[model samples]
Target chain A: ELKVEQNPLFLSMQEGKNYTIYCNYSTTSDRLYWYRQDPGKSLESLFVLLSNGAVKQEGRLMASLDTKARLSTLHITAAVHDLSATYFCAVDPYNAGNMLTFGGGTRLMVKP
Target chain B: SAVISQKPSRDICQRGTSLTIQCQVDSQVTMMFWYRQQPGQSLTLIATANQGSEATYESGFVIDKFPISRPNLTFSTLTVSNMSPEDSSIYLCSVGRTDTQYFGPGTRLTVL
Candidate 1:
């Protein structure tokens, strides 16, 4: 079974601060994804890291994947109030037909 | 990215009743997925719905309890049978394209 784990399940940071959420998987997989979910809302796609050393950034959020280490990271730079939400990292196991195993999620609270 | 929509954005249902959530995509997709997110929890893959085949369920899930239908490539339905308080959660449908999976708005089911 593929297990995905995330750190700092709950984070409280002031606006303009920076933080990083870590995601680690038990198995070897190159396809990883980052998603954000607001309260009572569905997930919003953040980034798709397909291979080792692949990094994707949008706005103040950047995501990177290290396949060899079975790890991924979502970096928040200069966070804002709007960045306060639950972030999730998912991993698609090899030949899993795109089925994703998600992490425990990191709930971020950005105080203004 | 694929545009997806789900019906009955949120509902409060009585125990033992069944609710069928519909998922529609703007374009055809080979694989569609159903996920469940309980309150204050992370996402869990319920099943994988593929066009022209029986839906593949994940561990701890069964087709009899959560029946899925993938009539075509652009649409699918997930029926929650014999609902209970434990089954109250946010159900989301997703479609994979390239390296990313786009999700629907989600259906919040509250069983009492």
Candidate 2:
């Protein structure tokens, strides 16, 4: 079974601060995805990291994948209050045909 | 990216009752997935709904508890049977497009 683990499950940071969420998988996989979900809303796609060393950035959030190490990272640079939400990283196991195993998720709280 | 929609955005039901959630995509998709997210938790794959075939459920889930129907490529439905307070969660449907998957708005089910 493929397992995905994320660190700092609960993050509390002030606005303008920076933080990074790490996603580590137990199996070898090349496709990783990051999603954000509000308290009562569904998930919103954040980034899709497909290859080793692949990196994507949107606004103050940056996500990168290291397939060789079976790890991915979502870095938040100069966060804002609106960035406070639960972040999840999902891994698609090899030949799984898009079946995703998601991490525990990191709940971010950005205080103004 | 495929646009998806779910009916009955949120509902409150009594224990032992059943609820059917509908998922529709704007375009035909080969792979549609059902996921459940408990409060303050990450998303868990419930099953894979493929057109013209029986749904593939993940471990810890069964067709008797959550029956899924894929009548066509653009539509699917999930019926939660014998609901209980433990079943209260957000149910989301997603479709695979190209290399990425898009999620629906989600249906929140609250069992009393």
Candidate 3:
């Protein structure tokens, strides 16, 4: 069975602080994706890590994948209140099908 | 990335009722997926709606409970039958193209 686990299901951070969310999958995957969901809003596509050692950055957020280790990370640098939301990491194990298995989201709250 | 529009942005319904959510894509896509996000929980994939065929449901999800239809490559619908409070959630529609999935603004359902 394929399982995805995320650490620190709930996070509270002060403004300008840095934190990282970790995602570990039980099986090898072809690609990994990161998404952000605001309160009562739809999900926003964050990063698509397609290969091992792939790294992507947008604004203060960065995502990386280590396919060999079956792990992915979403790093927040200099967090702001607007960046507070639930982040989810999803894995697409089969390269043929686009079905994504998502991890339990990490809810982050950034305070000023 | 394809722009997906989901109808009935939100709806409040009584118990034992049913609701059908529609998703329309701006471009043709072979794979359209439906997902459900419960309050404070991660997303669970309901099914993969393929054009010209029946939807493929995931484990713990049945075709009867969440019936889906895809008459073409750019449109699909998911109907939740006999809904209860337990069915209250955000129903999201997504399309996969070139190995990346883009989401639509979800339909928020509240079963009273």
Model 1 docking tier (incorrect/acceptable/medium/high)? medium
Clashes of each: 0, 0, 0
True lDDT of residue B9, candidate 3:
99
lDDT of 3 by residue, A1-112 (tens): 7899998899999999999999999999859999999999988989899989999999999999999899999999999999999999999878554788999999999999
Q: What lDDT would candidate 2 get against the real structure? A: 0.92
Candidate 2 lDDT by residue in tens digits, B25-108: 998888899999898788899999989999999999999999999999999999999999999999999987777778999999
Error of 1 at A65 (Å): 1.1
Q: What is the lDDT of residue A56 in candidate 1?
A: 88
Worst 10 residues of 2 chain A by lDDT: A92-101
Tell me model 1's lDDT, rounded to 2 decimals.
Answer: 0.92
Question: What residue runs in model 1 are displaced by over 4 Å at the alpha carbon?
Answer: A95-97
lDDT by residue (A14-107, candidate 1, tens digit) is 9999999999999988899899999988889888888899998899999999999989999999999999999999998963437889999999
What CAPRI class is candidate 2?
A: medium
TM-score of 1: 0.96
Docking class of 3: medium
lDDT of 2 by residue, A3-100 (tens): 89999899999999999999999998889999998888887888888889999999999999999999899999999999999999999996343788
